[model samples]
Target chain A: MKVKVRVVPDGRHLEVEAGVKALDLLKLAGMNSESGVVLVNGRPVTEDYRIREGDEVTVVRVLSGG
Target chain B: MAKCSICGGPAVAYIRYQRRYLCDRHFVEYVESKIRRAISRYKMIRQGYRVLVPVSGGKDSATVLTALSKLSREFGFEVVALHIDLGIGDYSVKSKEASIKAANKLGVPLIVVSVKEITGYTIPELARKARRPVCSVCGLVKRYIINLVAVELGADAVALGHNADDLAVYSMKSFITQDLSNISKLGPKTESIKGLAVGRIRPLYEVYEKESYLYALLTETPFLHEECPNVDFSSMENRLKVHINSLEEEKPGVKITMLRNMAKRIRDYPKPQLPISRCRHCGLLSSGDECSFCRLTKRITGQPLGPRAREVVRSLVASLQLAPRQDSAYKS
Candidate 1:
């Protein structure tokens, strides 16, 4: 979807075409659903959500803090 | 005017007892001397660096700030105050307020970060899903957040509010788990990733809990006296403190002294290493592909990505499995 993927780590980014769901696209780009956090333009997106062109995304390793 | 306790030098007044007129300045000098001795003995802080003191606005942290501030002035180093609010309602409020008060009182800059604002989940909600050992998660978060913030804000070291009793229980926990490597990381001084962000240091490593509390009381530093709600008194340290409190009627000072010594001994004879595997996904250090914490959180939030926290919400999944249990005799 021509998205800028920032893993808090830039090396984890991958550019792909639209039509792929955001979750699947992230998974394909080595984002582990178990420990990964997905934030599209600073807001979190659920798994079922899809990706569109030009989305600025940040994916983090889910740190469950008390 | 009071006579000196030890060297019998010029003294202002008797400090707590006879032959102990250490004087106000002398008392500070004495504490500072002990702190300096420990720093030199342990090689705690390096030259030309900023130390980040994690002040929770609690008595421990406020007293730590006051002492360290004095150290900074005398020892000619710098210090920064850091506060993290786990979003625990009024308790967290008290902590934050207390921290601000300390910062104002000490005239040090304080940084406050909230879990809800930074992460999207309050500590309690996250705790419900993340569950026990979330304390460690909180600790890790504190580390990561502080390091990240410190690096961004240009700090070099990080000090925590951990007391002697906390240290004792921590050492005991390590012994129980037989995790020598984790024990190794529990040193008075440990450097963080150089390229990653800031180096971390703990000035209060030698300071006792009771001493900290006493300092807070004597200094009148505004600090929260209550414990975090997440910490049940079931902790070994708490239990031990309670038992000791009943028997000896002494303040928390003894616990602090014993634990500090234990950690010092352990640090002196360092020989422990635990394997660290990075989380392939985030590149952060972890013991598994998905850390247990991450797995449980995902599972609780319907992700079921982890093993056990992934147990399905069967009540909704299979209506028949849930409908009949409320009243055994009135099963549908």
Candidate 2:
């Protein structure tokens, strides 16, 4: 099972394993899970949210500033 | 999908600290309520007071301005937005546009001050001429300009957008670096010195960085989602923020508790009493004969730009046509 993941502002895209937690998906996409909020099909979800097959995930980076 | 704790509607966010899921509306209300609590706890604004909010077109500042604008009517205070164009090429262009858009949406009068227009040098140019880091230069200029504008407009306080995560990371960094003075100034509000500095208040002091972003998104507030190009991702501050958030993931509410405890400790800590004096050049708050802004400009341009900067700010304020000592009046 594969899901599409897109990182905001940078517009980076990746394909990752489904059924994994949102936090793990962020890790798989080379981002710190703590640094972003995961959205599944435009709705905000918790880090424990499990991605489904073909789900559209958007990771909005929240950690800002130097 | 998780149900909202209050309405059992489709939840937009799960607040780990409180162990509650919330819909978009409730999440926004929750964020705004936290801001109100912060303001009331600190007595940050008084009735009939005017607040000057400096916006950077970023999520935190945008959220701060939006929340305060909505709160102004309830609090009996007036809110004004200020944007300083740092002239950092395209990034600055986008930032200024977003700031203008946010202010326009709120019908808040915005004062636009350009660094290149006033100082005859962009931040990068000044950094190069002064042989200093860009971020350091940017911080000094922003601090100087914000205070100057606040005083010129006769605002009762300047509201900043520093959130809980920022305070937590800074607190940890300060402790690790043994910068006790910085820690001492990390509370929700800093008092004003008569005829010198304006009081600074943080309305988002208790809100998390992610919550701020989400509030702006849900409220349809305009903000630049991109980080400044000058931001160093590998900087110690950024790393510390990431590390702190990771701790938060393991133990919910640690950031808020840490910040609260730090504020308590700060209240008990003996504050360093530094002799405050007016800058001879600009007549603003200064630790010595010359302020850091004046010193930096003098070093870079062979002349202090503080007086000129003040003149620019004064003219801009005068152009606003605000009634003398009147509250809630501004020119678009």
Candidate 3:
């Protein structure tokens, strides 16, 4: 069930297990902040993105700015 | 070490097909390569003066710091690192850390200033109150704080990490505004008013942002790289830069040279008309009854900010700037 996962933040690459929620991938990527959004190919996705094989996930550290 | 072409000193870097040599202690030749000019080309440093550099822990500032540090030794000026912590979540924290690391690498004294300490409010609080854009508020606050602190430190000039990209934006805006005097004030060097104390300079004015980024990667500073979520990169300013940058391949130095020339022309021409008076409220330099910053600060402070806020909405509607929703005009 290992799927190719390129986590953002530290950009640590991982072979996370399949069906892993996006939030888990975020934590696995070594990111710990109040809020960091994620995107798959330029579209914002919630923490529940189902892990498929070969996903280019981009984690964005959202600054609570005006 | 490559021997100096003239003095037979050791040289490690090459420039413009010139086999230059500079000794370890007498390093003017090496400094010139980093600064892209001979020592005489720029008024980089004066006798026994100290410079405060506003570093963002980004590649641009890192390159500026390195270049200035090397050049300062030859030019005989003291260099100090200045960082403004915007409290932009992790970005600010990482930036401050990188700045500290850069300061350590360069062996210069560093001063840290934060909104929380100076202004009694963090960036989030300010942004929340005004509903103004984050970048605008943060940028103005940072610049104001740096200048004020630099002056307080008795620094001759405040150096910034602004690169060619930022300069190009200013040039374009100046051209659009047709404000010649404003352009004149924005050369490679800008001095504050006589009583203002600290001037502003961009020693890395000729350096490109991409080059800075690459240098950071090569230098291996522990930096957290992330763009501010607030700025919509698709905005007009960014889009124009990208478009003009794309055309740079067709004609080399098209955008830069043009901007450089425009800057020179403005420098050579008449000064822009100064705004009437300083704002009554905060008393920073201002062009109107209430500066744009003060107005924004009021809203950010959770005040009604009534009449001016309405004017903002009317102006937005009139200029077709931001959207003009009826009830939303006074929400701020």
Q: Which candidate number would show the highest lDDT if scored against the true structure?
A: 2
lDDT of 2 by residue, A1-66 (tens): 777788986788888788888778777656654578888887777677889986778988888974
lDDT of 3 by residue, B1-332 (tens): 24545567543222221224333333433333646551244464575667778788766677778777877887777787877788888878888998899888888777776666544577877777667677777877776666555544556777777666667666676667786566676667775554333567776565544434434444554444655546575665665565555454345456557655754565585776766454566444556776555666566564323233224323322442222222211111
Q: What is the C-alpha RMSD of each candidate to the true structure, in Å?
A: 25.5, 3.0, 14.8
lDDT for model 3 comes to 0.58
Select the stronger candidate by DockQ from 1 and 2.
2
For every candidate, the chain B TM-score is 0.71, 0.96, 0.73
Model 1: per-residue Cα lDDT over A22-60, one tens digit each: 557656755433334455655444444566776776665
Q: Which segments of model 1 are wrong by more than 4 Å?
A: A1-66, B1-26, B131-137, B197-199, B242-332
Specify the highest-TM-score model's number.
Answer: 2
* Residue-wise C-alpha lDDT for candidate 2, range B1-332, written one tens digit per residue: 67899999888888888989899999999999999998897788888988999999999999999999999999998898999999898999999999999999999999999999888999999999888899999999999999999888988899998988888888788889987778888899888887788889989889999999899988989999888999987888889998888888889999888877776677765576878898999999899999999999988888899999999999999988876663322211
Interface RMSD after interface superposition, model 3: 16.7
- For residue B203, model 1's alpha carbon misses the true position, in angstroms, by 1.8
| iRMSD, per candidate, in listed order | 23.9, 2.0, 16.7
> For model 1, how does the per-residue alpha-carbon lDDT over B1-332 read when each residue is reduced to its tens digit?
23356665544223221225553346556656656776677776655556678887676677668877877876666677778888888888888988989888988767676666544567676766566465766765566566545544445567666654455556656767776556666666666554344555555566544445545655667877566766655666555543433332223244445655765666554564535554443333355665544454455555422222112212212332212222111111
lDDT rank order: 2, 3, 1
Instruction: Report residue B14 deviation for candidate 2 (angstroms).
Output: 0.6
Model 1 share of native interface contacts = 0.00
